[model samples]
Target: MATTTDPRIAVLSAMAYPPYNETSESRCTPWAEAVKLLADYRAAVLREAADRLDESETLRDLTDDHMHDVNAAANELRRMASEETRPSDG
Candidate 1:
């Protein structure tokens, strides 16, 4: 797999893989942090795609696909964030 130079991306990538603790809070913290980082990264990617699309007619479809992926990531982040803030029965 390709490695990321960005520290945030690196941390998020590490969080994605194994050795997770058995505690709910421990697991949730990394998951939440990864979602937030991914959201931020995707937002940046979306902006870049928009700029590239504006600069050229070619690759428009590719750029649109990237934007769609970014939007999906953003939506997932929003859902996760909302769930994190919701009150628990416990």
Candidate 2:
């Protein structure tokens, strides 16, 4: 749903996830640690967003336009994460 052009928003949306393990980074190297830090942040954001949705009780009333926006965001995040994990085709 999300286009390749919306990386920043996608990352922010992912950040809405919550209840992360902050100490997970201690077990890894500097680079891996950094990645974990970002992941935790994204998870926390997603969790918060999910909580908001639960509290609002408006998912059923969401307009088609809004749902499209959410789908786009979810897709963009998925694509970005996949690209990051993929090996270069040199």
Candidate 3:
């Protein structure tokens, strides 16, 4: 289990990968690295989404909003990924 984890990482693990949040694996994997991996994955997904949008002309109507949401998610994930894995005060 994670005895001293950043809450953001804990919540992310709980929501995206419960096993990490509940098992000793949390200690085995560094939160900063895990979050960075997730952020990178999100960037790849966003790129895929963009390519799909570019290939489908009919979906133009929602392309802007769709990209906005994806970009927002990517930015937020990046912010979280860059945070301290362990609180300095704790």
Candidate 4:
């Protein structure tokens, strides 16, 4: 597996994910920090992909696919976070 040298990903790697109930960020749910970290990491991945456009086509394709998957995962987390705070109508 390829590794990233981006500092944002490194920061994310250094940050530990707290429990879903333990508040981590100000005025935000415990998992919000995690979601933000993931989103940041995904953004970094895309940026790196853009920078590496001169590389092989196979590598670019793989990176593009990876970026999409990361985006999907980040969006799913965003959806889950929104659902966590949504007022139930039932």
C-alpha lDDT of all candidate models, in order? 0.54, 0.51, 0.51, 0.50
Highest-lDDT candidate: 1
For model 3, how many clashes? Answer: 0
Between the candidate structures 1 and 3, which one is better when assessed by TM-score?
3
Q: After superposition, how far is residue 68 of candidate 2 from its true place, in Å?
A: 0.6
Residue lDDT tens for model 3, 5-90? 34445446545554443565463445665565455455555555555645566655566789676556656654553452323342
What ranking of all candidate models by TM-score puts the best one first?
A: 3, 1, 2, 4
Which of the numbered candidates is closest to the native, going by highest TM-score? 3
Positional deviation of 47 in candidate 4, in angstroms? 0.2
Among all windows of 10 consecutive residues in model 4, the one with the lowest summed lDDT is: 21-30
Q: Model 2: residues >4 Å from true position, as ranges?
A: 1-60, 88-90
Q: Rank the candidates by lDDT, best first.
A: 1, 3, 2, 4
Candidate 2 whole-model C-alpha lDDT, 0 to 1:
0.51
Query: Against the true structure, candidate 3 has what lDDT?
Result: 0.51
Residue-level lDDT of model 2, residues 10-52, one tens digit each, is: 4444345332456773322344434644554455455455555
Which run of 10 residues does model 2 get worst, by summed lDDT? 1-10
Clashing pairs in 1: none
Worst 10 residues of 1 by lDDT: 81-90
The residue-by-residue lDDT of candidate 1 on 1-90, one tens digit each, is 126755456556666653456775354335554555565565555555545545554444566678676566556655554554454453
Off by over 4 Å in 1: 1-8, 15-29, 57-90
Clashing pairs in 4: none
